[model samples]
Target: MGNKPSFGETDLPCPQPRQFPMLLWLLLLLILPPGRDQSGVTPKAFLLLNPPWSTNFHKDEVTLTCRDSLSPAQGDIYWYYNENLLNKKSEEIQIHKTGYYKCKTQRSSLSDPVHVDFSFDKLILQAPHSVFEGDEVVLRCQAREEAKEKRFYRNEIQIQSNFTLQSVSMNNDKYHCTALVRGFWTWNKEISKHLMIQVQELFSPPMLIASPSSPTEGSPVTLKCETWLPPQRSHIQLQFCFFREDKALGKCWSSSPELKLPTVWSEDAESYWCQAESVTPPIRKRSLRSQLYVQRIPVSDVTLEIQPPEGQLTEGENLLLICSVAKGTGTVTFSWHREGTVRSLGRKTQRSLSAVLQILTVKESDAGRYYCAADNIHGPILSKLIRVTLRIPVSRPVFTLTSPRMQAMVGDVVELHCESQRGSPPILYRFYHENVTLGSSSVPSGRAVFKFSLTADHSGNYSCEADNSLGVQRSDRVILSVTVPVSHPLFTFSPAVPQAVAGDVLELRCEAQRGSPPILYWFYYKNVTLGSREAPFGGGASFNLTLMAEHSGNFSCGADNGLGIQHSEMVILSIIGPPSNKTTLITEGVTAGLLSILGLAVTAALVCHFRTQRNSERLSTTGTPSYSPREFKEPSRTSNTNPQEPLDPVEPQPVYNNVNPGDSDLVYSEIWSTQHTNENSANSPRKHWEDKEPTVIYSDLKKAYPDDSTEQASIVDSDLEDAVENYENVPCVLSALDR
Candidate 1:
């Protein structure tokens, strides 16, 4: 054994088997350091780990240290593993791999090596190569062996522990792992594994929708179903289904999501929805519900009909019309129209109905085209036109006379009649004169007649009016004339003596007090008329003619005016001869003169007597005479010729006187002769005695003395003279004597 066999530098398996020899060798080696103390002086360095040992994988770490004395002199230090340099460091070295490691300081003189075993060290995984946003990448730090706990480290920072394997999200970074053994230093190692994670964006389903906003009822509608998707998905085929009330409509598949129907009716009203589908994994069913409203369109079948049909209507008749609907519903309003004017008849709102319009007592004004209309709340609908006609009956009318022929005279009668043919019933007839209503009689079947007596007052226009309900119609005007009867006539002669003289014109006029037009007058003078004339609308008629001896006769006049003839009172015309110019002589011997004288005296006396009688009668009848004579004077001289004898009362006297005288000489001639002769003698010779004394006469011996008879004559004469004197002086003179 002395020999441990010199084990220096020997490669023997049992070299250390014998300790004595090994110790002797190490002692020798130690003693022998004369060669350069190659065994590094006990290194003044300490090994340092960044993180403490833990069981977690991400918390493990290891550090190799080679601290040299002298404040780590500036010299390259070589880190060695098993006496081989693995890395060089000035101060320390880090180890990321899970393995046993030792650090040595190599200089001109070698340093003691610091040995570390990282058997429980963790290996850390680095960040991935590439990673996208929102991606999960695993970063693992695994320990070489299970440790009580593992800790991970990044750039000397400690991580969570308590795990055999630690993981972290990747962020493109290099990573390392470290682990700790219960009774040893921490061990850690970096891994070369890198991860590259790529992140992708998620896709969402497309949105589908319908269009057309809001739709109305009964209107044509279009539905649109559309979706918005990424442009990259445009090529994908898509199908859409439009549905209403959970029912599919028509063909559901279409390139576009819109459905179009030309028109919609009330029956098509419902809630609507749509769906869009694609070949993609998840089908898109996007829908919206919309309400569809249906509206009713009013029908237009309104008619108007008149109840009685339009025809001629009389006054006080009723008018009726009806408004009906053939096809309509809802509130129906009925209105009647006349002449384009509307009238409210009646209305029914609950249901469709009819309306009746009645107009009582129809008149002429009610005739017109009548129509009705039916209306719902929607609009007014007109009906067919109906014509209405009204008829008016004739009414009872009055009649009047329109002519001026009402009043008529005797022998003249006027006819007046009135007609009212339009009246309902036949009318009776009556006549009126000066407002006097006449007896009523049947009007016959035609014209009525009335007769009026002709009279002066009848000279007026007559009028007649026809009576009917329609109206009173007057006839043409008429005039009437009445003829009057002639009145009694009177006639008288101008010269009232005996008759009218010859060559005298006798006028005869005939007249009547009253008559009508066209009066004819005829005049007669001495039974003959000079001319006949007519007096129209009469006054009087006259005739003038030259009277002749033959014309003396009874004359009369005739008057006629168509009514009757009238005659005037007759008048007689007379003609007489004038007296002769011979004179008569009256004497006591009955001479012509004497007889004439005596006759004149007697005639004068008789005429006086008769005249006195006539005067007395006139005075008695008329009460008094018009004239009377005053007292008369007697003869002054005593008459010598036995005074003129009184004239015989019976004999008539001549109107003329004659005288004869003879010349005498103192012959005692009668004093009357003497006075006469003296008077004649006193006158001139050219003046005749006849002119001087026309009635004076001298009897032959005029102075014969009177005997006693003369005395008696004287006495008689005296008495006669006294009587004449008394008679002449009397105050009571005869009326004839006065005249």
Candidate 2:
């Protein structure tokens, strides 16, 4: 009766052969009993408790109620602690110790075991690893397990549940777990620490910091990302990324805290930031936004431009000096200055890329070398030195013809000097004579001197002009008269028929073509000086004289200016009378063309006579005899006419009154006539003058002498001559008869 059960068998009989060992049976019993009943129907067995997990603090007793689906009402409950049986036949049991516990109902197999933690320091509220925007966060409070009358509170809200299940964290809500005990309420309640569920702003705007603050173009720049997370979760591993205006930059998905640019160009100018994200929790954070800019370099090809691109600068005109930078940005300042001047001619301040320094009214003093400078607060750039010269227009020029004397002589070298009072240097001068250019000369000293040989053609109006780059200016006209020596004089006579009768008038003229004005002309007969004449301006002179029987002699004329006197060729004149034979006297020196001046009335009468002679070649000598009037005595002689005669000035006549042609062969003769003698010498009465003489005066006088070689030529005989001689008693008449 005292036999113990062996390891593999017992005294009792069994149908199965080779039963399992005790340890094996125990494992089989634990694996197969909870899912089935002895009647071969499936039964469900589970534990009912006040909470889900264990706590560390002294907690309320947990009523572990085991239930089976096979049982309708109350059933026997079996309890175990650390795999050892504790009680049976109770529907529920209360436990206070922290250990492995399990239970079974009378109609079910043993249930799974649960572990309890009685350490109060470890009883805490736990939350999800990350809480992001627009996401649900689950929070759990762990305290006493499988206890009745458990209460869950969150931010002072009570949920009607025996145990805290889970919390969905939408904001930063506080959570805790508590329970009531079957014992007294003084000390058996289990409570958990409050848990704060934080709904974090997972990603904030990122802030960026640049190295070398302002970077120039084509230079390197380093940007840093400044982002952080909550202080408590700072240990979380994160990855860094960079962005610019919401676009990813180079190596955007990196873990580095900074981004480096090898060179910053113009295209890199934009707003940039960085982001930091947790590796596991997928939480991302960004820094505040920052702007990045790349600086522009200075222009290299700076230039200076002038307006009016051509011509020189003049006073009272607007001048523009443009100082410009072809490539650059921002404010640029321009300045203009002369080379020798300390002050700048102009200055301009502007924000544009180019600036112009303008001089509204330029002055003559502004002439000098010029240059320009530009600056944009970096450094000054100077343009190449440019020279500007102010041009002054030439003034009225003063012309001087340097004649040794006041008179300009032919074949003399004359100096012409032209100058302007106010003008720029390098002036050109030109001389003009009668509107024809004589010469041109250039001089830098504002005056030009030219030399020219004077001639008769140069004796006219003289003027000069001065010219520079500005304009041309002319001087007043000057009259230039060149003195010339007189040429040979010429003598001529008018009324060129035959020899004139006694008391006939003769016209004589003297002329010279090349000489100065106011020439004096003189008439001469057989080496005796007659009268003289002077031309008022420039030309020749003429004279009138009466002829007598002694007028037959050599004649010439002379002309003189300031030079010596010049004489003309000599000529001979003859005195003629009417004769018995057919005689004719021919005049000479009519073919010589001598231009001479006469009085206005005399010239008009001569023109009328010429016209009449041209119309009628000859006049009728049968009409009543006409005699020409006597001319006033002015001592005059021509190349063929003499002044030593006592003849009236010769005028063109058709015929003499009461005179008939005796057809004389003699060119010269004397007249003798009979007259009444008185006893007393003073008591003679004159004969009638209109009565026709025995013959023409010339014929009667010539016929009074005895004919030596003639008979038909003689109209009167020697006895007639003796009768006339006995009647006249005058010495002068005897003298005429003696000739």
Candidate 3:
């Protein structure tokens, strides 16, 4: 070194500017350690400080050395101060100036710039120009002579004298010192300029790295914990650890810087990081977290399930078809198909294991076998088949009643048939009579029949019901009439006189107690037909005629409906001429009294008969009748119109015959009629009430022929074995017969 220029002078030699500075940067790349200062360009060269302090006395000399990775003998060294060139060629030099200095080599880039401070003041703060992080450092505050007292500060804060930094971190801190020195005889105080300490990094932070960053499932992976240390500190032992989402990937701590994974799965996709620590210094560092993702497995084992469970689904109901996969990952496509259809019923694409397709309203056409398929990146997988059947609701049931005869007579066995036109069976059919259930029957696919024995109560309205689970349907009502056979009738005449003369008027009545409505009655004389009258509303019929000579004979009456005709016992009738004038004149005096007595007696007898018939009817209706099931014989009709007979329906209510009080030859009689249900007859009632046999009561008032004046009245009761008692009162008779 010839002579070093002062830092304040800008004029210096320029060594003929060459392109080597640019070429040097391009040729020799400086690979920096990890976590090296990121704020500036990387430096290929560095400076070594002698005495280690940047601030020193002006008279003190400091040695500087230029160090680089290149060989010292292969390149000459150049030096700069405050960006100005200096005349220096050796790799080492001595300086006593305060300025920023840098160096370069012929084959290497420029080193990082450093600052030096030379002070002429009495007080100075001394610290190293280049200090590494985590290094123990000592600071000194000095004066030209011994100080009586001294004080120091760090970062503008007062600190104790002789302060030492133990394991100091890489921080830029301003330091200064204040010293009290004895100058001549008086004491004086001096303060040094603030110096900022610069700390160099010893090693770089660790970085986490994965070879083949994106790995497939079941594939191997390699993980490395990367870091760098200074060449001087390269011999320091370091330990590394690898982690995934806070869980250790290998041994918690290992000397090896790498971790190997033989196989990875989808669950292994997570945040990963690495840690590096020095064994001697116990310095630890961690890398920033990185994300690792593993590919997924393929879709397989597809299946389809129907909502509402079984195949017993009804029409007009919502249907749900679910498609699922036993194992799959990533985006999946699901499709539902019917066995006989060309297009899929539904399709869905999503990141899920199952998908659903709903049909708002199912119909009969939707009944079929169904299946589903699922796919990912791999091929499609099919599910097992499922059959769905739609049940049809039962249509309005058709209800019908059948019997062996044209009419549903009592004791006849009839069948009630109920069927549904369109529906699924096993259908249940219930038979109803007058809105009340009689019995029930069930069939798999067609009509169902319930056998019922007809009774008087079973004659009203009839209906049937058909039901499946889906819904219930009912049929319209059918009307049935239970026809009953006519019983033997009672024949009688009006007037209480003993006999009837040729000139007297006569009335005859006939009635059948237990027969159905619309009964026909025939009046006969000596086996010859008189005429017929119809009692369309039931109870009885009557005929009126004048007693003539030809009418005197045995009189009888017959009653008939459609079932059968019954005839009454014969009554003897003998007609004579009118009374003699002398006798008539003799009885005429007491005629008023006799007429009153006869009227009272007749009224009493008629009332008693009516009450008895009413009682018998009430008992019959309340009790079950005994029945002998059989068919009744049909009646024959004969036509012989008589001029004396009234062809029209003479009366609908109870008949009352009028009598002439003046006619002493006229006779009146009250008739009581009753019916018997034969035990062997098919139309008989099933059970008799109180176990009582059938009986008929007859009471009559008669008048002898005018030749004799005797008047007779009698009562008779006849019991029929094993017969139901059904009775009715005959019409009252009040007729005047002239003698």
Q: Evaluated with TM-score, which candidate comes out highest?
A: 3
Q: Which ten residues in a row have the lowest lDDT in candidate 1?
A: 1-10
Stretches off by above 4 angstroms in model 1 are 1-415, 421-447, 451-459, 467-473, 485-498, 503-505, 563-565, 576-739
- The candidate maximizing lDDT is 3
By lDDT, the better pick of 1 and 3 is 3
Report lDDT (Cα) of residue 88, candidate 3. 91
Go through the candidates in order and give the clash count of each: 62, 31, 28
**Ordering by TM-score:** 3, 2, 1
Q: By the TM-score metric, which is better: model 2 or model 3?
A: 3
Candidate 2 at residue 213, lDDT? 79
Per-residue lDDT of 1-739 in model 2, one digit per residue for the tens? 0122122211222322222332343464566644544335444345656553344346656666666655442545667777777856676777778776666664555554544545554345444433434344444555444444556676778865533333232344566767653444443666667755434443333457898778876678888865544323445666778778888888757878788888765557788777766674554556666778778777556777777464267766787777777665445667888788888877786655577767777767776667888776678788877666677888899988888876667898998889999888888899888878888998888578888888777788888999987889999998888888778888887776446665778988889987998788999988788789999686889889888888888888988887688899987788775453433222223222122212323433443454344324324543443212111122233432546744433322211111223575332222333333322434422233234432334322232334444642232443333232222212222222212
lDDT by residue for model 1 (1-739), tens: 0011121211212222323333343343343332222223232222334442311243246555554333354556645454445746656666665432333333223332222333332343333322222223444555345443445554555656432212222233333545443335554333323222221111122222323444333345778764443222335567777777778877966767678765554556677777666654223445556676545456477777775655555567788787788765445667777866555444444344677778888777777787777776578888877788654443332344433434445555555766654443345544454444544445425667776555566654554544433344444444554545666544444444456656566565567666665777777765566578788766876667676666656777777765577777786666543223322222334565556555545544554454456557668998985322211222233333534754222211111111223353212111122111223344732255346543343323222123544433453444323322222211122211221
Relative to the true structure, candidate 2 reaches a TM of 0.32
